[model samples]
Target: MTPAPRGSVRQWLAARPVAAGYILAVGSALSYGTAQFVARIAVTRVAPPLVTTAFALLFGALFLLPLGIGHFRRARRAPGKAWLFIVLAGLTAASGVAFMYSAFSLVPLVVASPLGSVYPLVAIGLTHLFLQRLERVTPRLVAGAALVVAGVVLVVVGSA
Candidate 1:
């Protein structure tokens, strides 16, 4: 099918940003989940976890470098606090991936992957702690996080 006019897509995203955000999050989740499977193979069969983590991070940075180039000006103009937070975010994300790769090397993917997916609960708590002014941690959000944890527990138990 022919693509809709370019501005139509932008207008749609602008009109329904929450829906757009969810769509983007789902896409990211799919990519992350698939990457774990591939990482399992690499960590177990091809290389040790540390080596895999390094190469994976290096390749990831390379892949994003071009996209990031366009935003360099905005990133440069960001305040010191913003830069600090950005660095923290990168370090935490890298450490999480490294730990996950280590886990994958030890356990079966069925076990490791689901346990890793519980990051949402951690994210929920952190958001509540740090972003109280920006976003409310409503009961519904807590309940959803609880459900996610419960599902992860079920998956981990069932895979045993």
Candidate 2:
């Protein structure tokens, strides 16, 4: 199939940032899923989790270093609260990865992976409780969240 006209893709995304965001979210999941598979194998090869985690983080940071450079100036000038939240997000990701790696060592990837997806449920519940400004809860979102939880449960139980 011939590709769309040269600038069509950019125009499409510019027209709908929300849709572009969703597309990127799914794309991240695909890359992240592949990375996790590789990390799982590496962890199994190495006995120590810290060593595995360190190597994973180092490689990831190296790969991201150039991309980070593009934002370095803006990041430096970002508000203190923004920096604080950014650090918090990084710390949260690190904690999750540490636990996930440990879990991979302790359990089957099938089990551990599905269990990890349940983090969204925790995030949703926490937001409902702690985040004062949130979008109105609609039936569509409620149903979608229910399906995600159910699907993760089925995946975990099936793997067991």
lDDT, candidates in the order shown: 0.91, 0.81
The TM-score measured for candidate 2 stands at 0.84
TM-score of each: 0.90, 0.84
Q: Residue by residue across 97-122, what tens digits does model 1's lDDT show? A: 99999999999999998898888888
- Give the per-residue lDDT digits (tens) of candidate 2, residues 60-116: 889999977988998899999999999999888888888888888888888888888
Q: Which portions of model 1 show Cα errors greater than 4 Å?
A: 1-3, 6-12
Off by over 4 Å in 2: 1-4, 8-12, 132-134
Inter-residue clash pairs, candidate 1: none
- Model 1 Cα shift for residue 59 (angstroms): 0.6
